[model samples]
Target: MGSHRKPRPSSGPFNGRAVRTVLLAAGAAGVATAVPAHAATGPARAAIVSDSVFSNANRLHHTQTKDSFTVREFGNVRSASVRNQANAASVACSVDDKCRSVALSFQIVTIAGDVHRLKAVNVSDATNKYCDGCQTLAGAYQFVVSTPDPLKLDASARRQLADIERRLDVLTRSTLPATELQTRVDALAGEVNGVLKNAVAKAPKGHDRPDVTLHRRLDGWPGH
Candidate 1:
């Protein structure tokens, strides 16, 4: 009923940038149907986003579009179960000269609140356009997010870690006046103690864990 649509893009691994662009465009066009996972954390945590979907068929435009997001998580998500899906079907460009499926896009966050732009793991029927008959182009995923034992550190903690590292490097590498060097050493010791102390304080109370593994070299992203 419409002009020949372009052949779908090749199926392959998730291209986060490309998906992100598609999602943004859809959002701008008011096509997106769901918000991201609730990110608020406190005594009252935000509810999980159970499911979201966008399914539309414009016979006038001879196009079909579908998008779904199934996401659930904890404020400090030790584990998560996520599902993302999308399907775009079109015969050919009708009034518009462009044709393509809009895939999934969202960012992943670590336990300590590190934001990472990641495309949902997908099995998609990328482009099935200009076909003899309409067929569904679908993307499916079972995304599981679990904290790796424990996150290394949040952004602020990472900074403190860096400062501690810098001080150690100076203690070992830089040759300074004895008094100044001793002063620096003392400060370094204090910094190290402060970090360890902070960790101890943050440890869960009344919980019995054999030992906590401190990821001294761990780091987190800026935006959560």
Candidate 2:
């Protein structure tokens, strides 16, 4: 009878721990591939909210208008354009119909009476979208003033002038009554005139001081 050979033992550097580690790495890669890109991130943000007061007015068909004025002063002549424009925002529109917006504006104009021409120097304007209730919008402004000779004012005077202008701007957007609004306008005009008067007094002899004029107007949709 032939003799049987003994079985040879397996040989290599690989062990049971090494095989388990390879299997675990392959399982992790499979899990990562199954997950979606957005799922790995977070949820999206919500939409922005609008102003409640303005939004409510927009839904209703109510309309409102405030007081306005215009003033022109040159040399020794002072003229004004003032009227009651309470119905300025009134229009024939309902909730289903298209409505008009309200607007307020101020401008400074220089008139070349010799050539019958006019040039607008400074302007401040404000507007609100279609709304039924009484609403006031802040003015977006553009200011450009021309002086015969460049104005040179001390720091204190300049600060006072700036403060007056700020007050005038605040009054423009105010919800005050017609008389009150007119009063504030007149006072503000006086303040501006005071500053100009000082500048004119300090000007050198034989030099003509620049004449400043103020113009204000209110515009809205529909007839008033």
Candidate 3:
């Protein structure tokens, strides 16, 4: 058998002890800037931090958890008969059995004398880019259209106008900071508003009106 040879040790003058000492010193200096362990974890400080964090998380969950709803919005609605021209209409959906405050959608097909032929479409609050909060609640939908007919606006149209205005107010004032989804929502709201405006003012006799918006019921919470 061939005789085994010992591997030559490193030729450097530096020994393990010296190298280890240098490394330890360097490591200590690097960590020196960190906050002291005792200062970083006082009991009072820990309790405060934990409470704040928990409160924020709880608030977020409360906001995100949806209430049950059966409302839906649909396009291309029809009257009883394909030829039966319907008059001004409105549709309001309340998820709550009471329908006290429901989500609503509306469309104006044709204008009559003083009445704008309108219909309620559906309620939808699916998460989107613009209004992250769509039909979060059940509400009535209303629309007003005016034709050449010189009739007075009905109470239903007025009610819808007021509701629309209220919703707009809430959206502008209570909306949170923008997100990727919000961009899409803004675009959709703009499009819907434009359509409603055109339909509402189709009659030379009627005037274009601003939407009424509601005040925010939940604003200024510690967290969203």
Candidate 4:
């Protein structure tokens, strides 16, 4: 028998820029996934992202591409994933490309139907041990997502996590005036307590754990 025909090449330079772009959800539900033992509480619901290619100071020209694949749908929102879904994305001609890939993760604690969260985000397969362009820049973030935690995360999940965590940190720590700050801080405390209560409610009838750790900070990233 003849060999199967090869697939046709892409229309353009694989256009990774289209794939590398970031995506957000309006109101999404996540796939169930297992975290580290210590990470059981405070599942990330948003992502933060940073890459060697991004620079806010110098308007560098770069190509980016992204694709969001819906994994599951809840209410009107669909849980989706993103990553290097395209090829040879856009970027400044002067920019030095150092990283091959990146990834991040996040967790959210809901209080009174509102969400308060934390995250652990990271990037890997960097082109250089250190990237000059993106150094001192914040990493990305995303939801820890309730998906199955395989031994390693796939590209879509990794980048999603990195991007969401990077963004969520800002949302969590956004400063405000003293009066509003106190109000928000108290609101946050209530959210944490809400998560603890939910966990307790689901515990086995006789299970007794005096203390619960609400969040697990992923190491080696900016601002812990």
Candidate 5:
């Protein structure tokens, strides 16, 4: 008798660059906002202000490969979650060797009372790899206003949120250095904060002023 084994699927060498490009394209097309079910005039009224995804990859010949994934969330979040997926494979020959790697990350953000809380989870695994790392960085901004009505984002606030999403799109498609990308992201966040602050200050009297809290997070990367 002879033993038999199933043949493995044939997938060409993993092209990190191509994978990243496809992911970004899909992510850009998938950006959307979920509106609440009930139309109440209290704190129950909430909506997704902004949701976006980002990714990047690098390959050094047949020596090393690296990939990074990021998810950014903003606005009134009712609940949130994050998941990270990673994999790696290597083949060795007498003359040279080949290696492939991949990383994926997901995140969700939610709002509670006057505070926006974000929780994220990440997982990474590799075969024939020396080391792997994942990190999460989060930022939060709370806008407190004196009003009776539930927090209703005005037109300007919505515009700023849209701008933030656009900036993230640019970041993902850009070939700028890591530091430069960070700078652009930070600047956009600042713009959002400034817009929210102005809204809080100009809020009319008598009505319940809505307090806005902006929660930001970058999941699945080194140094968070």
Candidate 6:
């Protein structure tokens, strides 16, 4: 008869603790392989904001939630262009509809002759450093070019002059504080210089000639 055979243990000589450690390591490796390496998220971006002012018989308010945008200023804008209508369930985009969105871009010649551009979306703000709302003096005026109608030179010039004067009056009487008025004061000075160099003199004098601005300290930002 053959000698009695001894049964060997199925498990190796490794201790229970070591075996558990190996199993845990393998589980961790499997988890790592299942996850995607590029599944990381980026930092959140800041909200883009601008202080807009406009009127068309009545007034309009709009909002844009695009990543980047563009703009055009001071022209013969129409009311139909601004979709300030009912339920307005769609997005009103800017002049450039590259985003394939509903447009909200509008141009209006104020009674004072100041051409105003209001775009709830798409139109990019004039910035200095890089993107919208990115600089100390960054504004939504990247396309603030004047489209003058030579036929109405005297009329247009007088209107714009009146706008400058009105802006000066409102700014001077603003109560917002000096910080807000500082830039406006600077802007007023620039307007005064520009209107003088260009076409205000040819126009007749009257309320249209808003030359004298009230030098009052106000904090209300100019709506014009």
Better of 5 and 6 by lDDT: 5
TM-score: which candidate is best?
5
Question: Model 5, residue 64: what's the lDDT?
Answer: 28
lDDT string for model 2 (1-224, tens) is 12111122221111100100000000122221112322322221111110101111233544332222222112111111112111223233444543333333332221111111223322222233332333323221111122333233456655665676566646654556534554566566556556655654564433344444443332222212
- Report the C-alpha lDDT of model 3 over 1-224, residue by residue, as the tens digit: 12111222221211000100000000122221123323322111100000000011111122221111111111111111101110111112222211111122222222222212223232232111112122222111222223333222345544543444444434432334323223333343344445445434543443433231211111111112
* Model 2 regions lying over 4 Å from their true place: 1-118, 121-148, 207-210, 216-224
Q: Using lDDT as the measure, what is the rank order of every candidate, best first?
A: 5, 1, 2, 4, 6, 3
Against the hidden reference, what TM-scores do the models get? Answer: 0.28, 0.37, 0.21, 0.23, 0.40, 0.21
Cα distance off (Å), candidate 6, residue 221: 19
Lowest summed lDDT over 10 consecutive residues: which window, candidate 2? 16-25
Q: Please list the residue runs of candidate 3 whose C-alpha ends up more than 4 Å from where it truly belongs after superposition.
A: 1-178, 206-224
**Which segments of model 1 are wrong by more than 4 Å?**
1-58, 62-74, 91-103, 107-109, 112-224
Model 2 lDDT, full chain set? 0.31
Q: Clashes per prediction?
A: 4, 1, 30, 61, 10, 18
* lDDT agreement with native, every candidate: 0.32, 0.31, 0.23, 0.26, 0.33, 0.24
**Model 5 weakest 10-residue run by lDDT:** 18-27
Ranking by TM-score: 5, 2, 1, 4, 6, 3
The 10-residue segment of model 4 with minimum total lDDT is 215-224
Tens-place lDDT per residue, model 4, 1-224, is 11111232222211012122223223223533323423323334533222222221112422221222112111111222322111111112222542111211222211111223333332212121222332111212221223122112245444553443344334333433223432333343334334434543443332223222322211111111
lDDT of 1 by residue, 1-224 (tens): 42333343443222221111010111223222233333223222122222322323234544333333222233332222333444344434333343322222122222222223223333333343343343323333332232322223345654664555554444433434323443454455445445534544554433333122211110101010
Clashing pairs in 1: 3-92, 4-92, 5-92, 8-127
